[model samples]
Target: MSQHLLHTPLYDLHVNMGAKMVPFAGYEMPVQYALGVKKEHLHCRDAAGLFDVSHMGQLRLRGENAAKMLEMLVPVDVIDLPVGKQRYAFFTNEVGGIEDDLMVTNFGDHLFIVVNAACKTEDIAHLQAHLLADVELEVIEDRALLALQGPKAVEVLATLNPQVREMVFMDAARIELLGQECYVSRSGYTGEDGFEISVPNSHAVALATALIEDDNVEWIGLGARDSLRLECGLCLYGHDLDKTTTPVEASLLWGISKVRRTGGDRAGGFIGADVILTQMETKAVDRKRVGLMGQTKAPVREGSPLFDANNHQVGIVTSGTFGPSITMPVAMAYITTSCSQLDTVLFAEVRGKRLPMTVTKMPFVAQRYFRGE
Candidate 1:
C-alpha cells in the first residue's frame, strides 16, 4: 500500500473491525471484513449492511440560479427537481462522452451534488471552471457518508430516528441522529432498500458504531459493494462508463429528462447537448451497453473480449464478477448493435478458451427499492 493513500473518516473503525484494506480510488479502503465478500453480499441481501462511503465527493452549489447554472453542465431536469427530491444525471463532455455520473438533489436553498470518488478532483475543477461565478461551488470536505442498505435497512434506521421511515426512495431530508444534524437520503447504489447518510466527519465513527451494533447490520466492504452493484446492474464509472462513452451508448438515455431533449423547453442548453440530443433522436451509435451472463459456471472478467461464433470480435466486457446473490457470473459490456439484443448468443474469450454466454436483462438479482406508498 502507498504511504500517501488517503483514508476516510471511518478508516480506523474499519481497521478495528478487522477489515482487509486495499487501495481504491486513492484511498486505503476496506475490501472486506472478517466475514468475507460472499457472506457480506448475502448479508446485505437478507438483512442490512453498513458501508463507509465517505471517500465519495460531496459538493454544494449555492445561489439563486444554482439549478439554472448547473443546467449548463449536465442534461437533467435540475430546476424541476422538487425540493427534498433527487435525480441521477451525467456530466458530459463536448463530444457527448460521459465525464462522470452523479446524483443531484434540490435542497430548496442549494443543490447538493455527489460525484464519484475517483473523479472528484477533476469534477470539482470542471464545475468551478464552467459554472457561473455567482453560483458558488463549495467542496464539502467536512462530511462523511455512510450507506445502510438491505431489506432490513428501514427497520434499523427507523430505530435511530423515526422520521427516516417516512422517506421513500430518492427522498432527501435533514435529520437528527444521536443529536447530530445530518443529511439523510433514502437512496444508494445497491438495488435495495437503503439510505445514504451524509454526516459531519467528526460524528462519522460514532454514527457507524451505533449502526453496526445492530444485530441486523454488519460491516460491508468494497469487494461486496462491487458484486452487489454488479448484480443490480449498476455501472462503475471508470469501467462501464468513461470519457469515451456517451449516455446514449451507455443505455442511460432515460436519465435525460424529456424537457431537456431536442424538442423541449430547455433542450440543447447543456454541454454536449447537441451531440447527445442528436444521438437520442436518431439512435446513431453503433454499439450499446448490455448485460451478459455466462452459460456455464466459469467467471468472465473485465477486459475479456467477446466474439461471434466465427471468431470475429464483437464486444468487450466492462465490468464482470460472480454475483453471490444470483449464483452466476454476471457482466456488463458494450457490444455491436446486432449482438446487443436480449438472448443473443455470444462467446467470451477467457484464458485461450471461448466460453458461451448470453445477452440477458440486467439486475440479475431482483431490485428491492423501498418507494413509499
Candidate 2:
C-alpha cells in the first residue's frame, strides 16, 4: 500500500468486506471485491451494483457573473443550463486541447461541478486564475459519492427514496435518504440506467450500509467499473482524453451546444474557439478514437501499436479489456482519420503477433438512460 494514497470514506468498510485493494489515481481503492469482476459485472447488468466514487472532486461555484466566467473556459452554453439540470462538458486549453472533462449541474443559485480526481487540484487552480474576483469557488471536501447502476437500480433506490424515480437522465435533485440530505442524479458512467448519490461524509458509511443491507445490491469494485464504462464507450480521463486530445477528435462535439458551434451570440468567446471552429469547418482531424473488436479471445492492452492495411503505424490503443457483456475483447484506439470508418480492418501488434481487428461502432452495449417524459 502506498502511504501517499488517499482513502475514500468507505475504505475501512471495503477492507472489512475483503476487497482487493489497489492504487488508482493516488487513492487506495478496491479493484474488485470478493465477488470478482465477472460476477460483479453480471450483477450490475442484471440487478444492481453499488460503487464508491467518493474519490471524485465535488465543487461549488457561485456569483453574479458565475455563468459568464465559466463560459470563458468551456465551450458549453452554461447560461442556458436550467436549474436542476446537468450538462456534460469539457475544459479546454487555449489551443483546443482538453484540460479535463466534467459535469456541471445548475442548482438554481450556484453551479455544482464534479471533476475527475486526478485533475481536481489543477482544475481548481486553472479556474481560480481565470475567474473574476467576484466569483466564489468552494471545494466541498466533506462529501462522498456513490453510484447505484443497472436495470434494477431504480427499483432498489425507490425502496429508500421514491422521489428519485421521477428524476430523468442528467437531472439532479436534493432528496432525503435515510434521514440525510443527499443529492441524487439519474446519471452514471456506465451505459446502464443508474443514479449517483452525493451525501455528507459523516453519513456516507450509514448510507452505504443501508444500501448494502438490501439483497439486491452488491458492492462492486473498480475492476468491473472499468469494464462497464468501456462497454459503454465512455472515455476515461488521462487514458482516452488528455491535454493532447481535442473534444472534436474525441467525438464529443455533442457536448458543445449548437448555439456555441454556430456563430451565435455566445460563439467565439470560449477557449480554443478559433481552432475548434476551423476543425469544424474543414473536418480535417488527423486521428480519431474508435472501438475495435477482435475475432479471437486474445485481449489487447494499452500501448499496443495499431497498423493499417499498408503496414503503417497509424495509432495506438489507449484502453482495452475483455468486455463481459459483449463476451469478447474490446478496445479503444486513436486511428488515422482515413481508417476510422466502421468495419475498417486493422491489426493490433500484441506480443509481436499481428492480431486482426475491425473498427466497430462505439458503446458495444446499448445504453439504457432514463429520460422521464
Candidate 3:
C-alpha cells in the first residue's frame, strides 16, 4: 500500500475483524472480510450486511438560494424536491456527459449530498464555483457513513430506532441511534431494502459495533459492494459512466425530471440541456448501456472487447462479476446502439476466445425497496 493512502473511521475495526484491505479511491478500504466476497454478496441478499462507506463524500449546502443555485448545474428538478426526500442526480458537463453522479436530500433548512469518493474534490470545487454568494457549502468530514442493506435491513435497524420502520425508501430524517444524532436515509446502492446512516466520527465505531452484533448482520467489503451494485445495473463513476458518457446513452433518460424536459416550464436552463434534451427526442446516440448475461460459467470482465456476428468490434464491458444471487456471470456493457436490443446476442472476447453474451434486462434480482403501505 502507498504511504499516502487514507483510512476511514472503521479502519481499525475492519483490521480487527480480519478485513483484506486494498487501495480504493485513495482510501485503504477493505475489499473483503473473512467471509469473502461470494458469501458476503449472498448474505446481503438474504439477511443484512453492514458496509463502511465513510470514504464517500458527504456535503451540506445551506441558505435559501441553495436549491436555486444548484438548479443551474444539473438537469434534475431540485427546486421543488420536497423536504425530507432524497433524489438521485448527476453533475453534467457542457457536452451532456456525466461529470459525477450523486444523491441529494432536502433537509428543510439545508441540503445533504453524497458524491463518489474519487470525485469529491472536483465536486466540491464545482459546487463552490457556481453557488451563489449567499449559499454556504460545507464539506462534511466529521461524519462517517454506513450502509445496512438486505431484506432484513428494516428489522435490524428498527431495534435501534423504532421510527425507522415507518420511513420509506428515499425518505431522509434525523434520528437518534445509540445516543448519536445521525442523518438517516432509507436508501442504498444494492437495490435492496436498506438504510444509510451518517453518524458523527466519534460514535462511528460504537454504532457499527452495535449493528454487527446482530446475527443477521455481517461486515461486507468493496468487492461485494461492486457486485451488488452491478446486479442492480447501477452505474459506478469512472467505470460504467464517465465524462464521455451522457445519461441518455446510459439508458438513464428516466432520471431527467419531466419539468426539465423539452417543453416543460423551466426547461433547457441547465449546463448541457441543449444537447441532452435533443438526444432524448431524436435518440441519435450511436451506443447504449445495457446488461449482458454470459451464456456459460466463464466471467466477462471490464475492458473486454465486445463483437458482433461478423467479428466487428461493437462495444466494451464496463463492469462484470459472478452475481451470487443469480449463480451466473452478469455484466453491464456499452454496446453499439444497433445491437443493444433486448435478447440481442453479442460476443465478448475474453482470454483470446469469443464468449456469447445476451443483452438482458437489469436488476438480475428484482429490487426490494420498502415503501410504506
lDDT of 2 at 339: 93
Poorest 10 consecutive residues by lDDT, candidate 3: 262-271
Name the better of 2 and 3 by lDDT: 3
Q: TM per model?
A: 0.99, 0.98, 0.99
Error at 359, model 3, angstroms: 0.5
Give one digit per residue, the lDDT tens place, for model 1 in 7-80: 99999999999999999999999999999999999999999999999999999999988999888889999988
lDDT of each: 0.93, 0.91, 0.94
Positional deviation of residue 290's Cα in model 3 after best superposition, in angstroms: 0.5
The number of the candidate with the highest lDDT is 3
After superposition, candidate 3 runs with Cα above 4 Å error: none
**In every candidate, how many clashes are there?**
0, 0, 0
Per lDDT, what order, best first?
A: 3, 1, 2
Q: Model 1: which residue pairs collide?
A: none
Window of ten residues with lowest summed lDDT in model 1: 259-268
